[model samples]
Target: MGRRPVHVVGRVIVGLLALALTGCAAPAAPADSALSLGSTAAAAPVALTASATAAARTAKIYSIRTTDATKGVITVIGTLSPAPKTGTRIPLHQWIPSARRWQEVAHGYSSGTSVTIKTVQPGSVRTYRIAVGPQAPYAAAISPMISFKHYVWRGIFKKGLLATGGNATPQFNIVPPKEGPRRAEADLLADKGGYVWGEVNSTGCSFVRNWLGNLTDGTVRTSLHNGRRR
Candidate 1:
């Protein structure tokens, strides 16, 4: 009757209070669980860092000049400031007549602030440039392009070439350097851009051919009328 209703109401109130107590007691895990995940660990902020400065940079190069000497040799002279670091090598580039671009040929370390570079004189008139490579804070710099050419050995084919033949047509030939991706006759022509280190002379008695065979030791031998002539 009336007691039963009151008892039921009392039980309902106790259940509601127990539910509120459990809700407050339990801790939230969504935020904390997310932070503990492996993916979140990778996004952590980096720690701050600091240190002191080091010696001031002091590297510079100036003025490049090339001179042609006897026996196909060229001397390159230049100056550097603050002395170069040991193992610092300077680069020399030569212009490719066909490609119309520059390519590095040789490199060497400097001798104190003044640099003396010796290179085989170019076989033909060519252009050269000195490049100072970039070092950390410094940017790369290049020297004024210098042109080098040897005085043409003057002669009117004085000991000239005359083709010889019996009852047939004569033959003439021109040879070029051996090593390259492609062989070209551009250097063998007799035009303004050509070079000659030897000439041919022939008469009806027989056929005589003279040509320059560059030896490994920088000395050239000429095959004359009879045999090998220096």
Candidate 2:
């Protein structure tokens, strides 16, 4: 074969150099690209505008009044304007008496114009609050405390009375004293005191009464097995 032409080597070198130059140049970016490093082209920080914060603070207030002793439910109504910005989410929290702090219950995007929370029973009294910004800025009204009480009445025959038709009688009672055994020492004690008593035909009888008390100071006391004559 004829001597390899010197121009062939030169052409190869030129092509390689062209390719290297093309690779060194920055790649083309989309028109909406956010990868710019210059300060002028940098992404603007998302801020919670005063108006948005105010709207969040103005969330409508609804009360949940429950006479039920077991559980309580509350419904909250509110509206959002201009939708929440990215990286921002709505938060739901309930007041915790034991912890003496607010705890997060649920979180969701602010996509919808309105937000509603249903059946929030994490605490005896739950308060709902929202965060419009990265940090919490608005708090909903403190929901009425849902009083919970277990009204349970139990009766057990006195160990000895169960076997024999003893004088002992089974009795049921209520709190805040009411009618029932009057003269009987057991009845008298339970009446004058905080409990109510029922008749006892069997060896032993017992009862329990329950009710909701104010939040300021609440207490529940159980009675002793034997009645105190005093």
Candidate 3:
């Protein structure tokens, strides 16, 4: 081939060099797009953590009450708002007058949102509440305080004919079924000349007891039997 012009050769060489440089130097991604990608990746874990914390904070304790006052028994209940991923532990707190602070008395674990805990009867009156410890997506919570006392049954007496000889009927202060038939002590009074008979009902007893009394010439006679005595 005939020798090419210097200018033409120079132009071809420059064009080839320009093409190579363009291929080697690829276009860079937009600054905004690159920065946005990095930011999204970095915030993913934080967003998840915040969501978990919020879910845990929403959990709460709602209600607690005395189920069996006479037995010193109590029931504690609560709701887990959105519910937790796993079971949660519940603890019972009692106010100690001597200590002047709350003390943990009992604890239990639950799997569902609705929880119920029953406590064994205590020896004395006590103020109590229920608490739930942190369970990841379920936060810690506490219930309202409740007080319980041993139940007592009193007698209601009806007397007829005050002098000479008379009859008296007695009713007991009892919440049927719950309190049921119980053992009790009562003071019987017989003035002048008359007969007194009454039934006593109380807690911690399975059977009922009745008493009968007779008075004459300023003397009193007492007896106890399944049926009325004369």
Candidate 4:
């Protein structure tokens, strides 16, 4: 081969130096505990930071989450530590400002460590609580009231978050359920497990069927109505 020119050699050296510099300056990838040598994950249970004050409550209620799946239909869930015994009858209560008492709105049974309660919550924001029965060996307990506000979608700056088929609807409502002095002092949210219970007051829950959109196109809408407490 012919002898390389001095400029060509200089260019090659510069390129090599640039490559080395880039290698040194590149950011390290985040540690993948599954593949990293020194990365480790917690092997023990984590402590919860709930702030519930009740003698009957041996644990804390981390937080409450609400989801609006269909219009006027809402699913309420809560997490708590020291799960309740299965088959325990609990009464879900709603605050009655007029009567100055917590009225039973719905009822649910404990299956696991958490409670899943469904309600048609479309009216003005209302507060809810779960009352655990203290029958026999169990002491009567009440979960911190979680006041859920009705879900409303804001189109401002939120129009571009969804694709044509992508639903930009609310994934979950970011509000607590408790209200007033009996409410949880701090918002202790649990990503996994914490302390929570749920109940319902028979004849206290309500729902309404509503029809919304109708067009030649395949699109549909709903003008659903929520529950009413008497």
Candidate 5:
């Protein structure tokens, strides 16, 4: 039996080579399906309350509610119903005036029925909408903008000591303003004081940026004010 002095090393090398070739011949795994349960298509417009007409035209309305500021519990309820459809998911989004962007807040399947969102921010106006089809939709509600008023000092002072011919330093002081009674109109007119200070601080920057921010903030305040009235 020992006569051949079997070439065990050669056999082991061949076996390893065969195993390596086998691994190389194996097929790759398949990719996952593109369709996801939570995914949806662009949403269609739905009727909104009279107070939300302006926002509804430009932004979709999803849901609205009043809540206790301290406990975060819902006190008022509002809901939106989309047209009947199958395999459709609707997402609620809010317009962020500061960022000038729409952000998704919540999402769920629209079973041709109304889903209520509860425990929302008190005195806070919000928007929601639905997305249908295979592609994700931009469904959203544009809550009427809320108005917030704060005071700002509109004075200037010297920056450095009396001896140095220091440049004038602009200063501002923010103070809370009184709330006005809700108006009947969908768009509420509210006065805000802090924007002027923001503009003053952004003096050296692009005028457009400062202007846009102030403008958007003002618009949001007006929207919120109107939304609350409804």
Candidate 6:
């Protein structure tokens, strides 16, 4: 009977040891499962990053200059962000008051990130801008408007003048004094404050008196009339 009790104790100890091993092994299952899940999550991020859409490009005109006043030549310089492809077409636009719309005046090709466009426009004051059309993966963009003023030179003198649609009876003889050849030229210019001024110059004979009329919206044309001589 004592041997039977000892055998029963031995079986009980073996059962406890097995239970302890099962408990220890149970904890290891969670640790190994957690490690495997973390590795799977790390690779899942690669699939999440597949083929993202590209960002749109930006365009702007940084400078506009009247490079040649005499020729009325202007240059429009600008840049495109994330630089566009080589030879991309960039167009220059001019605001037409008569049509009340924008007109394409000139165009240039892109070189690196920069583009330079030049056009000759004279005899008017207006607004200008540059634009680029959407060329795949890039959005269409336009630059801010820039104001440009160009003047035309006019001459008035013994190149005798007559009033349009007016009676000619009051005409005074404007013979340049026989002393020398006389000539006069004038142009309408604007100040930085947007004030318009008429400038006149004469060679040989001098203009003794002058007058300038108020600028009105109807003043689409600038005219210089010479009166009296010294």
Identify the candidate with maximal TM-score: 6
lDDT tens digits by residue: candidate 3, 1-230: 45568778999999999999978665454565657688886788999889887764343446555576445566666565555445577777889999899998776666667666677655557787766677665667676677756332322121221222235432223234434332233345544454555443233433443554332346667665344345
Clashes of each: 0, 5, 1, 21, 14, 0
> Which scores better on lDDT, 5 or 6?
6
Candidate 1 displacement at residue 123 in angstroms? 4.0
lDDT by residue for model 4 (1-230), tens = 35568778999999999999888765554454435544333422221212122334442234544465333455555543456778666566778888988877666566766666666554457787776665433466677767766653221112221211113332222223233221112221223222222121223223322222233234333222222346
Superposition error at 144 for model 1 (Å):
1.7
- By lDDT, highest first, what's the ranking? 6, 3, 1, 4, 2, 5
For each candidate, give its TM-score against the true structure: 0.38, 0.29, 0.45, 0.37, 0.26, 0.46
The residue-level lDDT of candidate 6 at 225 comes to: 52
Q: What is the alpha-carbon lDDT for the whole of candidate 4?
A: 0.47
Clashing pairs in model 3, backbone N/Cα/C closer than 3 A:
56-137
Q: Which candidate ranks first by lDDT, i.e. highest?
A: 6
Residue 21 accuracy (lDDT) in model 3 = 90
Off by over 4 Å in 4: 1-56, 59-66, 152-230
lDDT of 5 by residue, 1-230 (tens): 66344777678889999999878765332222223322322122233333354432122334344344333344222233333344344555555667877776555554443444343332334443333333223234433332322122221111111221112342332222222111111111234432212212222211111111223433432111111222
Global Cα RMSD, each model: 19.0, 16.8, 12.0, 29.6, 24.9, 15.9
Across residues 63-113, which tens digit of lDDT does each residue of candidate 1 receive? 333354323455666555545655568877888889999988766677776
Which 10-residue span in candidate 5 carries the lowest summed lDDT? 180-189
After superposition, candidate 5 runs with Cα above 4 Å error: 1-63, 67-69, 73-87, 119-230
Q: What TM value does model 4 have?
A: 0.37
The regions of model 2 sitting more than 4 angstroms off are: 1-69, 85-89, 97-100, 107-111, 120-123, 133-230
Error of 5 at 82 (Å): 6.4
List the global CA lDDT of all models.
Answer: 0.51, 0.42, 0.57, 0.47, 0.35, 0.66
Quote the lDDT for 45 in model 6: 62
The residue-level lDDT of candidate 3 at 157 comes to 23
